[model samples]
Target: MINKKDIKTLIVKKPLTLDCGRVISDFPIAYETYGKLNERKDNAILIFHALTGDQFVTGKNPVTDKDGWWAYAVGSGKAINTDKYFLICANVIGGCMGSFGPSHIDPETKKAFGTKFPVITINDMVNAQVNLLDHFKINQLFSVIGGSMGGMQVLQFVSNFPDKAKTAIPIACTSSHSAQNIAFNELGRQSIMADSDWKEGNYQNQNLNPGKGLSVARMAAHITYLSKKGLENKFGRKLQERDDLKFGFDADFQIESYLRHQGSVFVDRFDANSYLYITRAMDYFDLPRKFGGNLSKAFEKTKTKFFIISFTSDWLYPTQENKDIVIALNSIGADVGFAEIESDKGHDSFLLDVPDFLNVLKNFVDKSYEELIR
Candidate 1:
């Protein structure tokens, strides 16, 4: 179990600029640190979390008394290897996990920002992270590593601050949100708002939550996180807890029971309004938009080495997305390597116990470290 008493929260009391031409000030960033920061501070690894992730990257969660989400990749001898590298993970802006988000109080109305929170882009999330880094006096990072939405932020960091990181690893991600992706996100948003209890995003004041709506949304989205083969292999037509199906509103299938459990646990740890804000931020992410819609133009000035990894079964952001990032990087002569791991775990493969991917990461980070020193 991780020590909760020592868990500290740092706040940046200033407004920030957003991609939508809006300002967010007096913001507070919540973060957690593991391992000691060496004198040089270059031993630091900045980790960006995905849509529903918090700063509890490793160690047990204080709130729920559960294991950390990514403990598999971030222990003493793990891939992130806490013994050697100082690790930092912060709850991103617009996140529900201790960071300023829709749940945070708005200075203007002194109420929760709710739907009034400005829409943020991946660049904006990176900018908020920059503030957190400044607070910690980390001028540069040894590496920036992330998966899924976190990967989007990683790309944003390398593009915006080319000199800040020596290496970047963006796993199971796209350079930008595709139109189809946006539509899927919108459906989730609509499901949340459609709940009568949502009360135009003011559900917090009434102490009511759109639990059913949020669960439905989660259930729908979680399906995209896996491949058809994975789902089939894991659950298929297996019956749940009964020899024969009742066939009437019962969780007759194993998959249905699993999904219900996912939704229930997710609602406990996450806020509904935050779900809206973060998803919207993800939908607006477009790396090439900053450079006249030319994807290659985005990496023209960067010297950062990139290791882009994708899972063969991850339809959410398939191997093609990784290829596009590599092609663009190559267009500008950027140092880049791409790998597509064969796995049935789909988009969640990176977070799972995959020896092959872990070995690749170990080698990649080690090589980058050697190159930087030489």
Candidate 2:
């Protein structure tokens, strides 16, 4: 029940051409800002969110009543240090959170775009962000930071607009989605498509939402976000309530109950079609392929500093994947710092309270800020 006024948005009347040859005119972008821009406007930090994250980065979300996803790491005196920097986050083009997406109405047809929304790539998402930056007159960003899919956007931003950011921070992400990563995305897509209520992605007309399928998709993907050790430590074959096994199909274990709750809660806030579109975009991301099969070439012309990080237990985007990026950066002699934090928290470690990770961020940002001012 989020109205347009509830979130700050910018509407671009100019037609935006997509990578898939589709044009969207007069679209809206939803965003949120923290701190304030200085007179020189050089203290701006652009942050991107993960797959299901919105523009809410450090405040209460009016729509969900939930605290911002990165609230712990971003605030006045936190790692990012909003007191000393201007922080901005925008919902990507294919996001369901007040942004133009499959759930929004098409001015021409007067109905939701749904499946008719053109397939978008990671590049397309970055282009939309560029437009938003233009609207705000932010010629350059102090730094660009993100994790997971957001991390993909960070890589795309640095490659596509080398001069727009002074520094780049991509955590728990791969330059290209691996075959296994693509497989997981495909599995989620199939789960949504298999639901009878999906109705070929036009469920709105039938008044029957694809909640069941979407929930199953979320449940499956949620498992990939956590480490096996973390899961074991959390649930550990514990029962949901009763000590005895029900021996039935019901959720007899704590893990099953936890996943079910995650799925159910997700369906209440996200759109099924948006999920499909965003996942497809991630699967299509291949930085090396985009730049003549030379990942280093993607940053050959740039002088932007880099801070890449990976979690030890993050199988989704393992330390080796991050090292590959470091190798490419080193091959071109690009200024880069890479860290593989030892953690049992898995891919979601970046979002959790990891002291080492926070310290690294604070140190990098502090050093960069001092250098910029000097």
Candidate 3:
């Protein structure tokens, strides 16, 4: 059985080559593991988190004092069934939570990397995870599963390491960011850069942070994660503890109050520069482009079984986008499954409590495990 320990942070001493020709050396990766790896080590399942998610996937987050982001879908006997599989989740390198990012210190200058940090792509994040897996001596993964930005990493992992994972699941994401998606990310980045305290991404040096700007950015991005139907169902024209309009800009509506709260809570835990870097990485992600405009070529040699999912209300990554991925996989005769669930939960449905989604996930993992053992 694998020994359980507190969240572990490992420093990769070797230089990591990036697509932009930049290199990162001696960077730290913070991760948390659930369950135990058996003697064979073939039962390992690597889970990649969303854009803002961290290593804490199924337990109490020591830093946030809150339940894990995906507690409902992962854990012993949950959809992922930690009891049957060794689950691992790590903070992506271009992330703020316990991974190498703009918030990390550059050994050369002894200051936060900030804008000075080399630009990273989804592939870079997957490369970091591969290095981490190498550290653990795990040659083949039972499965790789993720949604949203995490799903992007899932795609990257399968494309770059075709023989590494036996099964791959990418949910509510696309191989490349859509024009609308890039516009939304650009808006968030602009919000941070427009903040007066941002100080041109050197706010750390001035002992100031762009809390307000980052908060606004979070508020804006949070809107995209929800569908109009879901938002109306949750907060539809409700007032925020007020009887009527106050005739002022002090959050007269319940939706406004809820969004403000999201923004406020986010700024406390995430770095503005990290937000900038991670969003840029997403905007630059295009698996087909990297493989010379042949999406099928990216997975032609892969033996991995893929299960792709999309939510009906997820406009950020609509069902058509997922269908496109399925088509590409089909073109190459790759083993694949596609599910477009009927849900009003929007792009965030994968992370929320959706019975249908969870059941699908559980069945897929169970079947994959069954095939592995046979």
Candidate 4:
């Protein structure tokens, strides 16, 4: 229920050139800012959000009645320490939250773009953000930080614009999407497209929405976001609003209630077609080939400092992946640090209130800032 009134849109004709050899014309990128840019324009920190996150990262979402997604780690004195840095968060180019995507009207057909939105790559996404930065007149950023898909963008940003950022932090991310990971995303897309109500991504005008498909997709994806230990600790065999088990697919356990809540809420805010587009973009992201088919060559000239973080229990992108990235960075003799925080919270731990992660974030930002100022 985002109030169209408060939302401001900036449109760029042919904003991003897709890796699929198509150009996204007359695109709009939705963004929100916190704090003030310094006179030198060097205090700006770009914060990238994951698969489902929007521009509303830290502040309260007046439109949804829910607290901002990363409120716990952002804000005045939080881990990001916005009070000390100029924070910029934008909905990725292919996202649905106020950004141009399938739901947007296609000037060519005078209809919703729907599934016709050009396929994009993570580099394309970072390239769009660079265009937005140009529009804002930000020549350089203090740091770029993100998790999950957001982390993928962070890494791509460094690879694409190595000299533009003072530091880059890619947490809970990998150098490339694995076949197994791509399979998971493909299943989600299949769920959405398989729904009878999807109507080939034209459901919006057909008076039908692919809520069931989107919800099921969300449910399956949500499981990957948490750890088995976390699930057991939070909702192990717990009954759901009942004393006796009259199990007939009626949410017999607390875990079922949790997953149902995640799925239902996800459908209300997200567009099914955009989900397919964004995930496809992530699947197509790989830097080795982009860097002339050698991962080590990507960072060969990057002067930007890097801080790679991962979690022990994150099965989605394990610590091994982070280590491989570190190895590549080291092979190029890049200034990089790796911190694999011991946590059982899984991939979602990056966004959660993990004290260890917070300490690392604070330390990395402070250290990077000191290096820049000195």
Worst 10 residues of 1 by lDDT: 1-10
lDDT of each: 0.85, 0.90, 0.90, 0.86
Question: How much is the lDDT of residue 181 in candidate 1?
Answer: 82
Cα RMSD for candidate 2? 1.0
The residue-by-residue lDDT of candidate 4 on 1-374, one tens digit each, is 35766565678775456788886667778888888887888888898889998888878775676788888788898878878888888888778878777888788788888888788778887888776677779998999999999888998888888888989999999888999899999989999999999999898768788998999999999999999999999989999989989959899999999999999999888889889999998898888977777888887778888999999999999999989999999988899899999998999999899999998899889778977854
Writing each residue's lDDT as its tens digit, candidate 2 over 1-374 gives: 46676798988787889999998878888999999999888999999999999999976888888889998799989999989999889999988988788888877788778899899988888888787778779999899999999999999999999999999999999999999999999999999999999999888756778999999999999999999999999889999889899889999999999999999999998989999999999999999997788999988888999999999999999999988989999999999999889899899999889999999989999898899754
Per-residue lDDT of 1-374 in model 1, one digit per residue for the tens? 12435446676767777878998777767788888888888788899999888888888878667778788888888888888789889888888777778887777797877888887777888898888678879888899999999999999899889888888999999988988888778888888999999999988867889987888788878888888999999999999999997969979999999999988887887888888888988988888987898888877777888999999999999899889999999888899999889999888898888888988988888778777843
Query: In terms of TM-score, which candidate is stronger, 2 or 3?
Result: 2
TM-score of each: 0.96, 0.98, 0.97, 0.97
lDDT of 3 by residue, 1-374 (tens): 01124448888888889998998878888888999999999889999999889888987888777799999899889999889889889999888777788877788899988899899999999998787788889999999999999999999999999999999999999989989999999999999999999998999978999999999999999999999999999999999998999999999999999999999999888889989999999999999997898889999889999999999999999999999999999998999999999999899999999999999999998988898755
Query: Candidate 2 versus the native: TM-score?
Result: 0.98
Clashing pairs in 2: none
- Give the distance in Å from residue 137's predicted Cα in candidate 4 to where it truly belongs: 1.6
- Which one is best on TM-score? 2
Which residue pairs show collisions in model 3? none
Which segments of candidate 3 are over 4 A away from where they belong? Answer: 1-6
